[model samples]
Target: MDKLKKNEKWFWGGVVLIELILFYSSSMTYKQQTSVPFLEKYVHGKPLKSSLSQIHFNYGGKEQSIANDGYYHFVEFFIRKGAHFGTYLILAVFLCLALYTYFKKNHFLNVFVPWLMTTGLAAFDEFHQGLTGGRTPSVTDVILDSAGALTGALIVVIITYFVIRHKNVKKV
Candidate 1:
């Protein structure tokens, strides 16, 4: 049993390490971080050029071209926010798992601790981005990341509740 627990710890630790790698890689230059490569070729007229190109927009009965037009910016915004949400989501999930595995009780602690830790990590990530070239830190991103983490943690909590309820039913 101890060996199994140890292995689980290592596995979740690896998941966390991968999330760190993703967070760090995301802090690199804009060109270094490419999201949705498959959509790039089809949407941008070429590969590696989704957020880097100017797009056309129709606004208030007038047509205009902007670096980040309505459609393009919308897509780019989603991509960036999705990345933030996903990375933090994974982090929170693994964190909650690890904490719960270790403690095995205290539901509130298991949930809130992971949320707080993930939120702090998100803030640190933005601070790290500020130190990198071509990257600027934004509090809004931190908020987005926190929301993502909270969502991930909530999902785990819900699943755990169901699993425990099912087990209790079986016992009854």
Candidate 2:
């Protein structure tokens, strides 16, 4: 096989691996997925807690400020949301890379297809979460995941644009 085919296979493999991770995590109950214990064990200190105590905001119909939920819960909230964002971002990036060659004739399809696939996956993930104990599916999470996917697809599009532009300039 050619180098491009090998790279495409690797990219698709990455997408599969990420999807498996999402599935495994979604299968676990909230109790099983909590990072609080790990944080409490390894990050011993009041400095972070005290400094962030004043920060507060509402999320998922509840107040998530450090003052309302304590430092650990507050921190955990961001960690979980960040994970959602980062995971979808990587998923979309991999999908884009994997689909790029196939959809190269249409730039719009190259970006749109990956974003749509990532969004569909995010929706499915949330639906899976609804079946898990102590876990509630949220539309808000799906939105966040979609946003992350869009960002990742845009990043690939931007990079490709620059690379192609540079090559054209070099040719001239």
Candidate 3:
């Protein structure tokens, strides 16, 4: 309709695209997975874990470290956990943004479209991981992603319902 509205579409479109890129980047496991700079600090100077540190490095290029053990292992475990939780937040954001856009145009499918897109994106991410060096597709991740989308949809619907009701009450 106007420039502002058109720009809004582009803005949200970028958000979706960037999120996809981040999702893929975070899941991939390559040689340098553990050679993270901060991780290297743990090695103390030998370029290897201390005898007490039970670390697992995927590839030995002095980069790309996957934690097989030690504190690094703990970090890796928590990172995965955190990633899943963040995925839920992203799903919610995308669905909310999409519905907001659709509302401006009276698009009845807006709510449904977000869920469809979110799942499709999750499936794509899982599939992409399958092709990566050391990554496998997990049905669990997809389920979590979908669950996040569902939660987002329900939240928006509930919020909107209450807002409309409150407005009517005020008018009366």
Candidate 4:
């Protein structure tokens, strides 16, 4: 009974964490009409500057820089494009983890289940946008979101396989 209670707490805690992540990234998203200079240009494509990019994502060394505004706008575009998708991705991960932990089992279903949860998460995420100030949902975004969920699941499958293999090797 105590273990069950502890499991429930952890499960809910993971869901709460997903909500928090969604809230944060969604908040980071710049609305189309906002006064923020770069983001405004990024959304509407007013052709602000040929050289000026909105996002300055620093990959690593100072030498590597992407100055093309298209890439910046693309990044911004994905942020808007991916809001719902991010929700799906995160929820799927948590659900998969919780199920794996609970059954104390793992398999192909570990990957399958997260994608399943993603379906509901994708819907809720879009619905959330309807309630928010300047956000509108898109079907394309949901597609992208589902893509992200699948991608995450694939990664988990790879990692889980390796982990299980290592465990077996250790037992030998």
Q: Whose lDDT is greatest here? A: 2
Count of backbone clashes, every candidate in sequence: 0, 1, 8, 1
Residue 93's C-alpha lDDT in candidate 1?
84
List residue ranges in candidate 2 displaced over 4 A. Answer: 1-6
The TM-score of candidate 1 is: 0.74
Estimated TM-score for each candidate = 0.74, 0.92, 0.59, 0.60
lDDT of 3 by residue, 1-172 (tens): 2443456666478557757775667576855454445655764544334542554443223322333444555455446646655665566555556556456343345456676777777788778878877776767677777777666656666665567679779999
Full candidate order by TM-score, most accurate first: 2, 1, 4, 3
- Pairs of residues clashing in candidate 1: none
Residue-level lDDT of model 1, residues 1-172, one tens digit each, is 2443566776478557956786777579766775445444568644334553455554334444435344444465557778888988888888877766764566777678889988998898788888889987878788888998898888878888788789789999
Model 2 lDDT per residue over 34-70, tens place: 9988877777884577668767777667887877877
Which tens-of-lDDT digit does each residue in 1-172 have in candidate 4? 2343357567668777887876655444345433345665655654444454434543222222235334455455445445545656666666655566543355667777777677657667667765676666656566677887877766656766687789789999
Ten contiguous residues with the weakest lDDT in model 3: 58-67
**Among these predicted structures, which one has the highest TM-score?**
2
Task: Give the number of colliding residue pairs in candidate 3.
Answer: 8
Worst 10 residues of 4 by lDDT: 57-66
For candidate 3, give the lDDT of residue 139. Answer: 76
The lowest-lDDT stretch of 10 consecutive residues in candidate 1 is 59-68
Whole-model alpha-carbon lDDT for candidate 1 = 0.72
Ranking 1 against 4 by TM-score, winner: 1
Report every candidate's CA lDDT.
0.72, 0.88, 0.60, 0.60
